[model samples]
Target: MRDFIGRAMMTLYFTVCATLKSGAMIVALRDPTWSWARGISVAADVAALGFLVLIVATTVARLPPVKTAQGIEPRLSALIGCFATVTLIAVPGVQTLPQLELVADLITIVGFTLCIWCLWWLGRSFSITAQARRLVTAGPYQLVRHPLYACEAVVLFGIVLRNPTWAVVAIGAIVICFQCRRIINEEKVLRSAFPEYDAYARATPILIPSISTLRELVFPGAR
Candidate 1:
C-alpha cells in the first residue's frame, strides 16, 4: 500500500514536470525571432522527454517494492515542486539567446552521456520489484554509491544552464538539496539491507571521484 502510494505520487510529480517542460518548449518555439534557437530548444526538450520516459519505464520494471517510510522526505518533495514550478515559469518567460543556448547544448550532451552510462550500469543490476535483488557493487557503483543521482544533478544543471533564469537556478538548487537528503536515506537503507555496504561506502566516494580510487579502478596495473 505504501509503495503504491509512493509510486503514484512520483508518477504524478513527473507528469506535472513533463507538462511544464513541454509547455516551455512550445513557448520557445512560438518566438519568431529565434527560429534556430527555438528549434534547438525543442530538440533538446524532446530528447529530455524521451530520456525521462525511459527512466520511468526502467525504474518501474526494475525496482523492488518501495517500503513505506514514515513520511515523504520534505526536501525531496520540495525538489520536485520547485522543478515543476521553474519549468513552467522558464517555458514562457526565460529568454535563451544563441550564446547561452549553445552552452546549454554542450552541457546537455555531457549530461546525457553521463545519464546513459549510469543507466547502463543500473540496468545490469536491475531487478523487478517482485523479485529479491542484491546490492550492486560493480561498474559505476564501484565508483560512487549514488552515481544515478549524481547524473541526475548533472542533467538538471544542464537544463538550468540552457535556461539560466533565476527561477530555474533556484529550482536546481532545491533539487540538489533534495538529492542530498535522498542519498542519506538511501545509504541508511543500504547499510541496513546489505552487510558489506559499510565496507563499500568506506572505499567509494559519495559523489566526487577520488583520484587514488579512480587510478586503482582504471589502471589496476599502475599500483
Candidate 2:
C-alpha cells in the first residue's frame, strides 16, 4: 500500500514535470530565429521527457519493499514540494537576446546527457523521494551519490547564465536549498535501508565530482 502510493505520487510528479517542459519546448521551437539555442533546448526537453517517461514506464509489480517514501504522510509542506522546472521553466522559451546563449546551449547538452544516462544507470530504482529499489554504484553513481541532482545543478546554472537576473538568481538559490534539504531527507532513509550507503557516500561526493572518481569521464563513459 505504501509502495502503491509512492509509485502513484512519483508518477504524477514526473509526468507533470515532463508535461510542463514539453509545453515550454513547443513555445521555443515556434521561434523563427532558427537559433541553435532553441535546437539545444528542444533536445534537452526531449531527453528529459524521455527519461521521465522511462522512469514511470519502468515502475513494475513485484518490486523491492520501499523502506522509505516521501509525500506518503499526506501533509503539505514546502519541503515536500519539488522544483521540477528550476532548470527548465524559470526561463522557458528562448530569449530574443539571451545572455551567454551559446554557452548555455552547450551546458544544456552536457547536463541532459548526464541526466539521461544517470537515469539509465538508476533504471527502475529511480524515485523522486529516494526509494531504494537498488543501490547503484556503477556508471555516474561512482562519481557522485546524487548524479541526477548534480546534472540538474549544471542545467540550472546554464539557465542562470542565460538569464543572469536577480530573480533567476534568487530562484536558483532557493532551488539549491530545497535540493540540499531533499538530499538530507533521502539520505536519512537510505542509511536505514542500505547499510553500505554511508561508505558509498564517503567514497563519493554529494554533488561535486571527486577527481579520482570523475576521471572516468566528464559525462561518464556511457552515453
Q: Residues 62-129, candidate 2, lDDT per residue (tens digit)?
A: 26646754564312212242443333443464463544677776786687678778877877776655
- The TM-scores, one per candidate, come to 0.73, 0.76
Give the per-residue Cα lDDT of candidate 1 at 26: 71
C-alpha lDDT of residue 121 in model 2: 84
Question: Compared with the true structure, what per-residue lDDT tens digits does model 1 show for residues 1-223?
Answer: 6545645655565566667767767776687776665566566676566555555555455565333223457434534644453353235335567788766766665666676677776762432122224577777888887787776677676778777778778767776776566666666666766688899999888988789878987899797
lDDT per model vs. reference: 0.62, 0.67
Off by over 4 Å in 1: 12-43, 66-69, 72-93, 124-133, 216-220
What does the lDDT come to for candidate 1?
Answer: 0.62
| Candidate No. with top TM-score | 2
- List of clashing residue pairs for candidate 1: 24-91
